[model samples]
Target chain A: MSVEAMLQTIKLLLPALMPSWRFFSVIAPSPRIEITLLKTAKDTPDSWQEFRPRPAHLSIGSMLKRMFYNARWNEALFLTSLAERLSSNPTEHSSQEILKRIKAELVRNSFDSFDSAATPHLQFRLVFVHREGEQLQKHVTFISPVYGSFGDTDS
Target chain B: MSLDYAIRLTEILLALAFIQQSIEHFRAPRDEQRLFIPRFILSILLLFGFQTQWVCLALVILALFILRRFQGPYNGGSDRMGLLVLCCLSLINFMPSSLWREYVFGYLAIQLVLSYFFSGWVKIKNPEWRNGQALRDVFQFSAYPVSEALRTWMNWPRLLVVMSWSVILFELLFPLSLMTPTTLIIGLVIASTFHLANACLFGFNRFFWIWMAAYPSILWLQQRIFIVEQL
Candidate 1:
């Protein structure tokens, strides 16, 4: 075909190719969070009340901060509990010293929100889970910014 | 020598560019707002040389009609009417505040003028451009992967310096060249070459094509270059 005819044909076909190109590419995931506003009541029996579900979009950076805070707190809590349990056991292995060192390293390397001089707002909780025959895992959960009695649903 | 060749070349290139962009947009129609879909479709039709594409083709025809209407001796008042309508359309189609779009359009409207006048102004501003050293610096700076090899070329600096000053002088005096045929041709040839160089080096393919297409109109103002003769 002539160059002119070929060019004309290509122009007619371009729009059909773009939709599929976009579908297979990376899609940004939205961060969802439940929020509650604290309110003071004068005439009501309860002084403070929990608000209903108020969802706010959390940015990825903020989400990562919360995750890191939770992980560190959980690891510290786990190590403390493990040390206490081992101390109560009379027949603890000689290698328990090495285990304690390993636990200390893990706790040290993990994120710490409170270093005495650190701001109170930076403090976070990390939950540690010990499974039988499996490695210990840490999960970070933030201290709810909204205070005055908000309970964790899973807890 | 034929008008047909020029028109055919324009049509083919325009069609190719439009088609490529249209296909890209079609595959990702969501990239643009949904309202732009019909405009895209119409653009595609225009590229294909379909009768429906006449809507956009009418815009160019309308511009020509307005130009012809204002230039003649019939009615002086009609020129103001045409100008008013043009101003209204321009105002209506005004794009929102965007630095990038502003630069793109501004660059398109006056690249040749700036290349000539500003380059000339710089030559006058400094003695280096007039003496040829400024051109040498430009060429040396432009030497990419071969900068080391180019550094060894001895007389290139002198030649480039002269050429650089010539460019500035040419640009500075280009407006006066428009008054005469020979000077106009010389000025346009230099400007065209400058734009062509920009296209090859910087990949400003769209701007190059648009500028080249408009170049004929500058010549058309001087003499009828595309009149068809009875064969």
Candidate 2:
């Protein structure tokens, strides 16, 4: 089997091995994983529910992936910068170009951290929120992930 | 009377829900585009009413992986509930002849009842939800887009308390809906209206449709399967 298939199998089995529950990506004062591992030695498999891993929203792997993703926001502003530019321009051709640029940059930068079997390939969307008086009125959205589709709506 | 009829109806409603949600996702496709391809594929299968069990199972599994990868089962209760429904459907498809089908349906029915119970129980533990302040605070937020009329109702603490308690009581008593077919129909109607109101008020359209899709399973368990098994 391929590595991807192996990883998928691991994810499915993880719940059984660990506890199937909900957990915050970041637990205040200390990480959930740290606490879970510490507690695991003394507790039975069923006792993991106290750690609260919401399988519906989070799994052991995904929570870590999100933490890593968020951690890199400061260092990797390439996508966000492009998104800002695209949102400001809010044009069809520019949106497409920004998307192409992002894909190329992802490859060129050798952003290997996010290339883990666990992490997902990122896409970008540019959203423009227009105002009616002081209140936000509408949204003009340009999506790069859908091959550069544009959507506009009065929110 | 047969499980076949219930399954067919559930499948159709689920298909429509998937299609509707897929369109919304397509509008502002997830940040992880490649990972979401399985979701796109599953939507197609569901929309066409594909009954190919193995293929549907593969697609559902793929979709779950994508959800895991994106850390998006975190999106909200809807994604979680949708995954549950899909998982249950796949299990039924995979083991068509085994008692596994009944077990899975029973599991779903129990989970459905638990969803409401736990939500109500959790809220009742909170002071805000108990006193109606939760609704009042929720409507005051711009994210929810409350109408001026609804927003004004926040000032009436007594009314808010009544509304809140109504929700709390109904949700707490939801499992009792399983007692009889008549109660089940009445409960489902009230629950459907609750979801509808939530959709209208909170823009939780996905929850509205997907929860409705799960109704057939609940109906099957309460009216048909559970009755037979109890005897």
DockQ leader: 2
lDDT of 1 by residue, A44-154 (tens): 222222111111243445333432122222222233333333334422331232233332332353322223222111111223222222232333222222222222211
Q: Is the docking of candidate 2 incorrect, acceptable, medium or high quality?
A: incorrect
Question: Which tens-of-lDDT digit does each residue in B140-194 have in candidate 2?
Answer: 4323322334456567889879988988888889988888888989998998888
TM-score of model 1 (first chain only): 0.20
TM-score of the first chain in candidate 2 relative to the native first chain = 0.26
> Which stretches in model 1 have alpha-carbon errors above 4 Å?
A1-155, B1-115, B142-155, B181-183, B200-207, B220-231
Prediction 1: B-chain TM-score: 0.45
Best by lDDT: 2
lDDT of 1 by residue, B120-157 (tens): 66566676556665444433332111123433333576
RMSD of each: 26.4, 16.7
The parts of candidate 2 lying over 4 Å away from their true place are A1-155, B29-41, B146-150, B229-231
* TM-scores, chain A, per candidate: 0.20, 0.26
The i-RMS of candidate 1 is 29.1
